[model samples]
Target: MQQQEIKALLSDMSLEEKIGELFQLPSYFFNGDMVTGPAGELGITPDDLRVSGSCLSVVGAERIHEIQQKHIEKHPHHIPMLFMADIINGYRTIFPIPLAQGCTFDPGLAEKCASIAAREAAAAGLHVTFSPMADLVRDARWGRVMESTGEDTYLNGLMAAAMVRGYQGENNDFSKKGALAACLKHFAGYGAPDGGRDYNTVELSERTLAEDYLPAYKKAIDAGCALVMTSFNTLNRIPSTANRRLLREVLRGEMQFDGVVISDWCAVSELIPHGIAADEKEAAVLALNAGVDIDMASPVYLKNLKELAEQKRIDEKQIDESVLRILTLKNKLGLFENPYKDGSEADEKELLLCASHREAARDCAEKSFVLLKNEDSFLPLKKGKESVAFIGPFTDNQLLYGSWSFFGDEQDCVTVKAGVTQNYPDADVFFAQGCPTADPGTNVLGFQKTPPKEEFDLQEALDTAVELAKKADKVVLTLGEHRDYSGEGASRADITLPSCQLELFHKICEVNPNVCVVLFNGRPLDIREINQKAKAILEAWLPGTEGGNALAGILYGDASPSGRLSMSFPYCVGQVPVHYNHMSTGRPFAGDYRTTRYNSKYLDIPNEPLYPFGYGLTYTAFEYSDISLDSDILHKGDSICASVRVTNTGERPGTETVQMYLHDVSASVTRPVRELKGFCKVFLEPGESRVIAFPITEDMLRFYNITMDYVSEPGQFEVFIGSDSTTSRKAVFSLC
Candidate 1:
């Protein structure tokens, strides 16, 4: 099945058959087949399902094989249905969340995690994964920040491309069954929703969208992602699903994304609600004309496309184009020849949470945990001497897998208590849950079950934790938001640790002053107070299936915490959209907050984030020398090399994410105070020194200006190179 074969098949498909290819219906198997699932209520008949080209959210290897085989028998053309699912971070062998993965700033490690996910998911016969979500999130309140890498444009682009490569492999060949066609999702500014709320309006200028928002997606395409998904939110005033200028002009024409453009779940139908289309028929017409290739979980295309084509409301050629794209992807996957595609109950069982995969998960989580604060080096605690109390809701609970770990079994997750016991069996280890992780309506992800009636005793739990703290030499207090607090429809106004956990921490600190706080969260939390109270703080954002094993390794000094922050942690929730690479303000706050009137400063707090982007700490420290440039100035079309020598200033071996930032001293349009251009991660032994060099080209300085033209105006530029974005080791150079 090649391009020629796809073209011939497109010609042979009937109108209804072609329409079926455009519609991707939902499928929730096993106990979730009805009552609350999307498939049972989506109003799709057997005939409709048979002709459908893809089914999403279906799980189990054997079930997928059954569906595809059954679908082929009913369809006249016998085109096998593609199995798609949101295997975001991992399949069964979960790794750290994408946010935590990004903190490593090691695309190589990100690639490894994605490769493991691809292998586990391929065992389940998935043809495509809606992953490597390239959305650049600046706000912590955006729940899907759990899925995003972080706030920066360049950093996100690097990780996005790496994931694409990992998913698609060297070529788009899953012949041996590991790689899948990666879908770069929520195309065009889905992360920048208004108010940092999920699915909210997105208003952005052409320059901002093209410069900051579009790069990551474009990078993914360049890495050969097989598909792109339309966003739920509107870009500018037009919804992305129906916006022809976006889907056609920017994506298809400008970016040359010839891959199948699929809509997010129900986004095609939601265009009617967005006031763009008057009815479902118009929605279908707009979506096709706008270049959306598939309607995901929306019956609008299946119901109205045929009628719209007959009525001459939409061109039939648009239908042919979309069907062609789908068939071509299927051809690339070799699905036309082998529809089952290595799916079997036996293979799934063999690959699910296998030993090597668990080890990979452990490695990923170990590198992804960031030491936010380590007062007097309280961490890397020796297991034999210090009797420790691991008291928290997360201590015995198997909720380590974050949201979107759809295929992972929570029971399979190794708990902190179990991991600790495995490591230090004889040590006196006291454990108590500070509070319930979530009680009743606390879940915001639309749980249809009756809300639990709770009589959770906050003070009783606190007193128990306090008593345990007094008995142990040190208390390992774990705290975080409920699992449902991030990912999908889970935006929060507070963006802090749950109140019960915070209150429990205060009470426990009254008994044990040498307490260490281990944070298990999705998005970055506002923990200004917790950092102040605790002797040590570890930010392990939803470390995946083997989270406990990885946490144990870090706590016991088996590995040093190496992850850096991809997104800035806000000083408070009031500073919603804080980041390190913000554009320079006309009136910069030069003095202290109280003294800085008429300047860009917060009344209650400083404008700076609690922790800047690219910030992280390990058991050891690295010292950076002032940057050395190859030349003071250079002409256009020339490149300059900036070099910095980093020394492992501390005794222990550690990994450091070396970041390089650039600033145009003067530009046609006002530029950011600093923009990340390049970075390198290096592991150093004690007294080790290595010189890392970054080659900067003219293209790195280009940006959209007032006329919407991307240009790099010749000017003096400042280059900063160090461990993080706030590095002051600087050198000056000029471009003419």
Candidate 2:
């Protein structure tokens, strides 16, 4: 529909109808019965469903078709209801979680997975996906870190843009059958909650907010993301849902995001509990005025918007503005022309979990496994030459898909035991459940319910595993946090393996000299103990449906491990918010502990992480030469070429990600010790060498200054080019 047509439709809508378009309810509200149970308790009535602009978390093509058909028939304006869900990674053909995808360091691959997810989701009648979470996370204790593309702002922005493109298709053209509108969330520093707690206060300076958190969302918006979801946290003492400075002035104005803004699940009404609003009416008024176009799963908009407008307490124009944006999105999705857009039972059957998608998932899973430790080159195990003992809870477990995979069933997932059997049929493979992922009485903290108890005696399981370990030539000890341990509202105080699993690991290590640990988890864990004990460690972070096959491929030499860490793995839980790009302090730890104790250093542990960001290992070793610069000076509007010769020194094919980092020696504000500016991935055969070059431009050096100005100060900058953030290969250049 054209602007004139949408405007005319808006002009014809009754005040109640326009106001209703701003409320998004769950699917059950439109089931042709009075809203009952939990949904009914929200004060939502059958009449509210008839005029609601969209439905949340609705699935199945047939169900969506039925609900949409019924909705349009009763809606006074006949505006089609938008069906939205949290399709973060994949719909049915589950891929790696966003954090794992970040480890791939391949934006193009991320885009491909998102495209496949969009295809599967659109077939199931989903019109919008609340995904491509652009939050920059540093704390591993925050369970939702699993959903974010790790700590770097640049990488997160790049991946966010790629996913936005993948979901919306080229040029935001939703006319394509498989394309679905993408929504970037949770807006404005949702990842940096105080104490790493979910929905906690986020107090960031305006400079830090723009310099780190806001760029990723802006990148997604610039890539034509159709909507933005307000975060649940309070940014700088103001609830994000009602922060006019954040939503209106910064988001819509500075970011130039014209997309429809929706509140995070019930965040509009949550303003009351946040101490910003007196009641639901005030909450609705605050959110609506603050530029939230839709109130998701909240009663604030439905119950008070109309009354507030009638009483002149709130402007009716706010309702019109929001309703117009909602209608614009519907038109962009081509829903006006076809209410049940691309939703077909046959399509859902053919598209979801298809062979091609599984193949893609397997390939992506292969690339996402970060080989954190490969001591003595113990991995890529010789198949027929050794008897392998697979010991742990995840050895045959199918719960590989992490949290927020609402539609993915565990039965369809392949197990590690099954993968080995299928890939290496002749190998002598023994299996035992050494220990459960967690103890039966363990608290998962926040919304995740207690998982079913494992019916096994602890002593018996330990004895069985130890016996297998002693008999076998190699012990593949699989261990990790339970799937329920990470994701929204699931923060943890201890980011380490459970005590039971640790005990099992110790028992196995005592019996077997050659032990390989494969970790299945969501967030980066404190693996200091595992690092010291295991001969080899593979960080296979909750690989999805093809997880088993992917791990087997890496273990048996079918594939090479190339994934790098997007977030740093800390030495212990005490280092909760560690990252590579931390600001330089006056008394920085210089790593020469013998020199002085007065510097900014921990007395018990090193300030550095156990594994820094961009750290990974492959079957082959890559040697980097000294960094070379084309010139010693970089003037305005000119570029400086920084080059390094990388060679595959080891005896197998591998992929290496060469990272480029820069440090601003002096600035108006304290800068990070080293910031990742750019990186490139290269595949190399043994004895192959290539010289990679990166152009250093002034635009890449710009940052938000103390005066809130985004500019680059001319100074002498140091550049480091090598494997990871801790690389010491450096060259100096002056930016004039």
Candidate 3:
């Protein structure tokens, strides 16, 4: 539909009809999932579903087409309902969680995964996916950390842009079966909730918000994300859903994001609890005026917006504006011409979890596994010769899809035990359920599957694992958080492995000292004990459908481990937030007891993370030469280059992520010790060498200054190019 047509439609909508469009009723309004919406509980008739702008979590190609057909028949304007779902990491052919995908450090691979998700989801009749969550996370205690790409601002923005491109394509074309609209979520500072608690208040300086958090969101918006979702938390005492300064002034006015702004689930109505609104009516008015176009799963908008408009307490023009944005999105999605866009049962059956899609998942899973510790070359296990005992909670459990793959069929998931058996038919592979995943009563999120798939008695489970370990030459203990432990509503104060898992590990290691620890959780864990005890540790991180195959593939030398840690793994949970790129401290902590006095060091534990960001081990080893700068004095207008010769010194082929870091010698405000400037992945065979050059343009050094100027400062800068952040290979150059 054209602008004139949308304007005419907006003009034709009555107050009640317009109010209906703002309400995104949950699927339970009709699906019997739960009793929700005005139609279900507030005495509104079934016809209320007709004008509802969208439906949430309703799936299936036929079901969607049926709903749209019935809705258009009842709606006066014949505007089709938009179908939206949380197609976060995957729809059916699940891939590694977003964080693990970020570890790949290959945006192209991430893009391919997103493309597969978009294709599978669109075929199932999902018009919009609330995905490409562009939140920069530092705290591992936050369960939602699993959903984020990691700590770096530049890396997050790059991944966000790649996801947008993968989902929506370059031309914003949704005409194809795989293409669908994407949404940038948790609008502002959702990742930095106080104490890393979910939905907690956030208080960040504007400069911090602008420099770190807002870049990823802007990149997604610029890449043509069709919508933005308000965060559940308040920003500086103002709830993001009702903060005009953030939604209007910054997002729409400065950033020029002329897209639909929707409230996070029931966020608008929660303003009463936030103490800002007197009632639902005030909440409705505040959100609308603040530029929230849709109120998802909230009663305030439908119940009060029309009444407020009639009383002149709120201008009807706000409703018109909100309704206009909704209409524009629908038309742009080509729903105006064909409501059943890209939704076909045939396509859905053919695409979801197909061989090709699962292969992509496996390939992606292979690259996403980070070999955090490979002491004594413990990995690349012998397939047929070694007697392997894989005993743990996840040995046979198919709960590998994590939290967001709501539609994922667990039965299709490959278990680690199964993968081992399949890979080496003759190898003696012993298995046992070592322990319960988490401490009892930790699941506050009300996880659906009442009986966890696998559980074992404390002593019996351990004794059995140890007995099996004694019989085998090697022990592979798989353990981590339960399925209920990490996701949107899940938050943990202590990010540690469960006590039962620790007990189980001890029992197994008592008899069999040569053990491989395979972690299967979402976020970075306090693996200090496991790292010290285990001969090798693989951070599998909720590898999806082909998880078992991918895990075994790495263990059996089918693929080399290339995934680097996007987030830092702490020595303990006491260090709630830890990262590699921190601003320089006046008294930085120096190693050793004598040097640590009067410094920014901890009383007991070291300030250093257990494993630094960009840290990973591969089968092959890469040697980095001294960084060479093109010139010592770099003119302000001219670009300088920092080059390094990287050689694959160890035998075997592998992919290495060559990362470049820069630090300003001095500035008006202190800068980070070292910031990741640029990185590239290089695949090398043994004895192969590549001279990688990072062009140091003035723009790469730009940062928000004390005066809020986003520009570069002319000064001497240190350059370090190597495999990870802690690399000391360095050079110096001066910017004139």
Candidate 4:
């Protein structure tokens, strides 16, 4: 239905129905915290779902069916409440966390994972998923890095589009199985938190917002996402939840997004803390007038909206528009036609975690593993090795799937211990919990809040790990952030392995020179020490459910790790803002010693990251040679073909990501030192070679032009081909 038609329908709504459309409490409201109004006249009984036109939680099939049925019986308009849940990663079938999925560099898999998640979630009565967080995360210290698609704009955009397609599918049909509406969340620059702190202030120039932050949301919007969730952070000193320029001017006007704009949980109320609004009433007025259509978990809209409309502070038109959009969303969801339509279908299922879902979970986990470094053909560990020591806290812990993981049983998840045992029942495998996840200084003072200690004592655990390593032929050390390190409200000042763990890693390496390090992390981290000590490094980003089987498969040559780094790994946290594509400084790096020291280079560390973006190693070796270009110059509407020969030199089959990058020698505005234009992943057998090529046109070179118009400028461009951004062969092209 057109929003205008829905507005006419809302004109006939009673005060009760209009107020109902304004408030949407959290699922905790029904399951736990029951709020009563001061007068006790207005509220909902826990057992009475019928009177509640909108609600938040829907756990299992049974509760969903019961709550859904109850709502159908009571609502006067019989409009069903939208069943919403934070099914961020997966519903019942968990996949690798978003960062790992991004590492796969496969949009098809990203979409497939979301589709499976939607299928399981929709089966359990979920109408919406606050997912595919389209925030462009540049800071790795932010705990939410795990939730984002990584630091690159183009990569994040691709992942966002894929996720939306996966979640929403090709149609708006919710009756069939596919995805529930994919909520493009934390809209705008929430990822640019001050000092990488979660929910901190984000002070960005308009150009930075447009170039770096806004593109992902724009891409998500273009992907046909039905809803958008505002951020909790303040943008330009205004809380995003109440920013008119962002919600009204940019999102609705410039982007032409007509979907429901929902505020982050209690974010409307947070304007008080932001010091932008006087109270909840003022916050509601600011947000509602700014084009926020839904008040998520904050009752301020219900409390003051009617009064505000009556006083003419907010026109009835604004309220009606908001309500109609929401009602339209409900109608599109088929809730109006069948509030309890398939709510009962959840109970009809015999198994929630079936074989197919688990298989998909395993496949996702397998693909998300990225091989970072492997010297002396150390990887694909020879089957039936005499003995191996599995050392780390994560070796047995199943909670390493990161945060917001649903429907994945910790006990059922494949731990490194279990996987190794299952994969090689005959081989002797020693195990040890190297150290506690928590820092010692912090843990001692926070005993009251901390969980009970598990495994061995911290020092003893490290000692045991070192001792066990001495007895084994090789050491397979699992390292990196624990489950609690990243996710909601978890940010870090230093993006490095905890000192104690680093010490343990060094000790294990000392004990057994033949060591393979498998990182179980959420986001990219500084790993200079690990790079020096370990002969091999693998980034296994919180693989969900079947993470163990996947890790074991990579270890035993059953599967090859092809995933690449989506986020850059800094040598140290201070080297942040270091990406593959960066604008060259007026004083570029000089080759001379004196000039290099004073130029745009850090005194303590190199400007380059430990591992550049698009950098990843594979078990088998691939050689790059024979670069060819169709033309040395490009004209208007011309496409340049850049081709290269990629040959697998090792005695095994493997996949290689053939990347193409471009550099602008000089332009009206400085361009990135190198920009990723195109990439193709191909599999090759030993001694087999293929010519991989990419065509680049004006569209590929277009940027926000000199006049602030997004267009391509005629200029000299350099094309590069190699494994990553930094190490590549270059050829110059002139655009005329």
Query: lDDT score, residue 232, model 2?
Result: 96
Q: Could you give candidate 3's per-residue lDDT for residues 1-736 as a string of tens digits?
A: 7899899988988777888889997877765533354465665556666678899998899999998899988899888999999888889899999999999998898889989999999999999999889998999888899899999988998999898888886588865668878889989999998888888998888888998899989988888899999999888889999999999999999889987898988999899999999999889889988999999987788878777888998988888888888889888888999998999999988998999999999999999999998889988788777888899988988888778778788998999988888877787788888777776544454534443544446678777888899999888889888766788777788777888888888778889899999999989999887988999999999998999999988988989999999999998888768899887888887787444678888788888899999999999999988988888877767898899998999999999999999999899887889988899999999999999999988887888888999988888889989889999889998878
Tell me the tens digit of each residue's lDDT in model 4 across 242-308: 8899998999999999988888887888888888899878998899888888787766787787788
Model 2 stretches with alpha carbons more than 4 Å out: 30-33, 443-446, 592-595
TM-score of each: 0.97, 0.99, 0.97, 0.94
Candidate 1 on 1-736: residue-level lDDT in tens? 6678789888988999999999986775323444345545766666777798898888778888877888899998999988999888899888889999999888998988898888878888888999899999999998899999999999899999999888888775655578888999888899998899889999887888999999999999888889999999997799999899998988888889888999998899999889999999989888899999999988999989888899998889989999999888888888889998867788888888999999999999998898888999898887788889999988987888777778778888989998888877886788998787764346554632222334567678778888889999998988887677788888888887766777788888988899999998989889998988899999988998889989998998988999899999898989988889888888988689987679988778988898889989999989888889999886789998999999999989998888899999997787889999999889999999999999989999899876888888888999999878898889999999
**Residue-by-residue lDDT tens digits, candidate 2, 465-503:** 999999999999989988988999898888889999999
How accurate locally is residue 299 in candidate 1, as Cα lDDT from 0 to 100?
Answer: 90
Kindly report which residue stretches of model 4 are placed more than 4 angstroms away from their true locations once superposed.
1-9, 32-53, 341-351, 441-452, 590-595
Best model number under TM-score? 2
**Which candidate's lDDT is highest?**
2
The residue-level lDDT of candidate 1 at 539 comes to: 90
What TM-score does model 3 achieve against the real structure? 0.97
What does the lDDT come to for candidate 4? 0.79
> Clash pairs of candidate 3?
none
Candidate 3, position 731, lDDT: 93
The candidate, 1 or 4, that scores higher on TM-score is: 1
RMSD of 2: 1.2
